[model samples]
Target: MPRMLPPGVGRRLRKGERIVLETHYHKTGRPEKDEGAEVALYFAKEPVEKMLHVHMLANVFLRIPPGSREHKVTASYTVPLDVTAYDVMPHMHLLGRRIAVTATFPDGRVQDLVRIEDWDFAWQETYQFKEPLRLPKGTKLRLEAVYDNSA
Candidate 1:
C-alpha cells in the first residue's frame, strides 16, 4: 500500500532500528511464482508546511449471517483538532458490497467524503480530494460499509 504524507512532516529511522512488514495472502490451488518485493521512500527538498496524519476507521466485530445479502457496519470518529483531509481509503474483504464516508460539522453542516456504490476487493485504492478538505474541531467522521454474505 502507498500513502501520501503531509507537507513539512517526515519520519526518521534511528540507528539499529528494525522494521517489520506483513502481508495477507489468499491461497490458490494452482502453483505460482513468488518474487521479491521492493520499497521506495520519498523526501522533500524544501520545507514542509503541514504535517499529515492517518486515521484508521474499522469495524472488527462483524457478524454477517450466512445467506444474508445486505449486512451493514458503521463507525465514527470525532476530530479533536482542526486539520485538512487530503485522502481517504476504504478497506473490506470479499463480501463487501458498498462503502461510504461522511463528515458532520459542529455547525450542523454535512459533507460527503467518499461513496463507493460498488466495492471490489481486487481494486481497492485511496481517493484523493481535488482540494484539501478543511475540517474544523468537533467534526464527526463517519464510515459505513455494506456486505453480502449469501451462499
Candidate 2:
C-alpha cells in the first residue's frame, strides 16, 4: 500500500539505516519457475507536516472445523494515541468469505472503517479513504472475519 505524507514532516534515510521488507507467496503444486518482484519508492518534492503510519490488524489463531461453512473470528485493538487513518487492508486465505473493520469511540459512537461482504482471495487489495479518518485515543478498532472450510 502507498500513502502520501500529510502536510510538515520530513523523512530522510540516514546513512547506514536498515530497512526491512517482507513478502508472502502462495504455493502451487507445480515446479518452481522464475518470477520477478519489485518495490518502488517515491519521494515528496517538499516536506510534509505529518508522517504516515501503517497499522496492521490480524487474527493469527483462526481454527475452523473441517466442514464449517461460516466460521468467524474477531480481534480488537485500542488506539494508544490519536491518529488519522488513511487506508485499510484486509488479508485472508482462500477460505475467507467476509470481513469487516470498525471503530468504536469512547463516547459510544461507532463508525465503519471497511467491509467486504464477498471476499475474494485473488482480488485482495488495500482501500484508501477519500478523506482521512480521525481516530482519537481510547477508540477501539475491531475486526471480524468469516471463513468457510467445508470441502
Candidate 3:
C-alpha cells in the first residue's frame, strides 16, 4: 500500500532538511575522486515519521576500465529524525559486487544499517533493516555505500 505523508514533510525537504546526495569513488592506488558515480535519494510516499519505508536509490558509472583495479563508490542522504529501518539498498551496474550502509551520529556512534557483501548486478533487491535504527535529535545521519567495479 502507498504511504500517506504528514502535514509538513515536503517543507522539510525543501527547506534544507533534506541532505544533498553525495558520491565518492576511490581508485585503486591513485587519488580518490567522484568521476562518474550517480546518487539518487527518494522519499517514500509518506514522511519518515509516517511511512514504513524510505526509498533510497543509488547508482555508479565507472569512468575507468573494468579490469584495472577495483573501485569503491559511496552515496549518502539525511532525514529529519533518527532513521529506523525503511528499506535501504544500493544500485549499480554489472560491476557492483557488494553494498554496505553505515549510519554515523554526531557523537561518533556508528551503526551498521545494512550490508550486502555479495551483490549481483543483474538482480537488485530492496534491503530491509532487521530492526528500525533510532537516531536522536541533532543527529547527523550518514549513509555510506561501497561498490566494486571489477571484471
lDDT of 1 at 91: 81
lDDT of each: 0.83, 0.83, 0.54
69 in model 1: Cα distance from truth in Å?
A: 1.4
For 54-132, candidate 2 gives per-residue lDDT tens digits of 6788777778889999999999999999988877889887999999999999899999899999998865677888897
Could you tell me which residue pairs clash in candidate 1? 8-48
TM-score of 3: 0.50
Q: Write the per-residue lDDT of candidate 1 for residues 1-151, one digit (tens) a residue.
A: 5665766765565689987776545556688656656676687676766656678877778788899999889999999999888888888889999999999999999998989898878646788898878999999999999999996
The better-scoring model by TM-score among 1 and 3 is 1
| Candidate with the greatest TM-score versus the true structure | 1
How well does candidate 3 score on lDDT at residue 31? 70
Off by over 4 Å in 1: 1-6, 22-32, 47-49
Stretches off by above 4 angstroms in model 3 are: 1-66, 138-150
Error of 2 at 59 (Å): 1.7
lDDT of 2 at 82: 92
Error of 1 at 29 (Å): 12
Q: 2 or 3: which has the higher lDDT?
A: 2
